[model samples]
Target: MQKTGLLFGSFNPIHIGHLALANYVLEYAPFDEVWFVVSPQNPLKNSEDLAPAQHRLAMTNLAINAEPRFKSSDIEFSMPVPSYTLNTLQRLNELHPTHDFSLIIGSDNLINIDRWHNFRTLLQEHSLLVYPRPEYPIEKAVIALPKSVNVLNAPMLDISSTLIRKGLKEKKNLRFLLPAGVYDYILQHRLYQQKKE
Candidate 1:
């Protein structure tokens, strides 16, 4: 079975960091493809802070267009608001029974894995590919990780969608922060130029 890694995020605007991580995982991991699962809203995040789901999805698609192994999935857009990872994984399994699915997360998320809905069950049923995040040392964690988790020393970037948005709003020199097409899309749409009301 082909292995697919799911990277779930709001992707308010997709950036090079997101692409780099996914590309690095594809090169190093057993995954044949990596899907950018664009969530409409994370349960922990404020929905009002998000770009329109369609725009976010579009940006993700634009960011990954050149990579055949990278895909953009709006799986949570049609689902209920504040989608859970467990639910998305189950649904993907049901939809694509032939492929093996793994959840891609950062070390920070691994630290808070228990907070996820049905997290224990999710861990038991699916493999997790964890990458490094600054200040969240996976090696020093006190929590006993399950056998299903694989930690990778993938490259970490200090860039984030939040940072990109702030930079755009402030007219900072954020060139190369995003893919050329994605940055062009954001500028074309005039997104993140004004302060939020």
Candidate 2:
């Protein structure tokens, strides 16, 4: 059976760090394909500064188009607002019963997983692959997580979408932070450009 790994997140902008992690997972993990499930809205985050769902999805696609193992999914976009991981996983399991589905998350998010909706059910149902986040320790999380969890010691990326957005607002060079096409798209669309007085 084919194994599918879901890398769900509010990829406000698909940065190089995100791509790097996905690539590393694909190479090292048993997963056959890694889907980037672009969340329309994260339950715990403020959406005010978030780029539109379509725009984020488009950027993700552009960034991963060259890779056969990387796929961009808009699964959360079709779902209701404030998409929860449990619901998404349940639905995906039903939709693709033949393939096995596992959840991919960062250590930082795992720290707050207990607060998510039906988080207990989420842990029981799917295998989790948790990668390290900058300034966050995975060992602590590994101790707390159930036997279904796999801790990946992939290269930690200090870059984040928030920092990239801030760089754009400040008119800083974001050449290597994101894909060239994605960077160009942001420039062409004037995304994150602060209004002048």
How would you encode candidate 2's per-residue C-alpha lDDT over 27-134 as one tens digit per residue? 888679999999999999988778888889999999999999888888777888889889988888888888788888999988878788988888887899999887
lDDT of 2: 0.86
Considering summed lDDT, which 10 consecutive residues are worst modelled in model 1? 44-53
Candidate 2 local lDDT, residue 184 = 92
Question: Model 1, stretches more than 4 Å misplaced?
Answer: 139-142
Residue 118 C-alpha lDDT in model 1: 89
Worst 10 contiguous positions by lDDT, candidate 2: 135-144
Clashing pairs in 1: none
